[model samples]
Target: MTPHNELRLLPWSGPDGKPCFLSTDDTGGPLSRLADTTETAQLNVGQEILGHAMDVLADEEVETEELRLLARDLATALRDTLRVAVSRGHRLPALDPSTPIEANEGLRLSAAAFG
Candidate 1:
């Protein structure tokens, strides 16, 4: 069986809003390139939205409705950013399973803090 990390989590959704995946060794393939481009665009848009949000927050006269709209847009950008992060994270090289657990001290600490 292929390792879970080897199966890429695509940047887009599949049927019924389910997450899509790619399981190919070709990193330079058409689909991979497309996903890369899309992730880039999404991140750029997210950056723009964050800048705009900061500007909006600095305005004391900002209305409730405008703030509400900004909130929705921010939510959308956050969703896209998270998707990109998840996809990229899965694509990273897997850690050696034979390595000692002490090598993952930070990971263990994080898990303990969260769990």
Candidate 2:
């Protein structure tokens, strides 16, 4: 069992698009693995959409309908990215509020930590 504070925010939503979470100490469990895969896929999709949006913006022949579609995609990607950030950020090591900031200099953050 995992502590409530240690609960992991799932990569997908639940009923009514509400946030979902997992409570487990098993980081390598099936659900954990699924969430990891989902997060990676979401990030890849966001990246691709960002590139497409840039290309669309650079074209003089772009239509209003096409711009609408781009906006939709961008909104979805931004939501996914924010969710991933919140989930990963919560999992990061906490620093002592009273400790000198330099005492935490050894900590490093990377995508691999979340995945």
Among these predicted structures, which one has the highest lDDT? Answer: 2
- Model 1 has an lDDT value of 0.79
Error of 2 at 28 (Å): 0.7
- Evaluate residue 58 in candidate 1 and report its C-alpha lDDT on the 0 to 100 scale: 100
How close to the true structure is residue 32 of candidate 2, measured as C-alpha lDDT? 89
For candidate 2, the lDDT comes to: 0.90
- lDDT digits (tens) for residues 1-115 of candidate 1: 3434377778788889998989887877999888888888888998899999999999999999999999999999999889887877665546778988787544523331111
Global lDDT scores for all candidate models: 0.79, 0.90
Q: For residues 1-115, could you state the per-residue lDDT of candidate 2 as single tens digits?
A: 4444588999899989999999887878999899989999999999999999999999999999999999999999999999998998888878888888898887787858966
Clash count, one per candidate:
0, 0
Q: Model 2 TM-score?
A: 0.91
Clashing pairs in 1: none
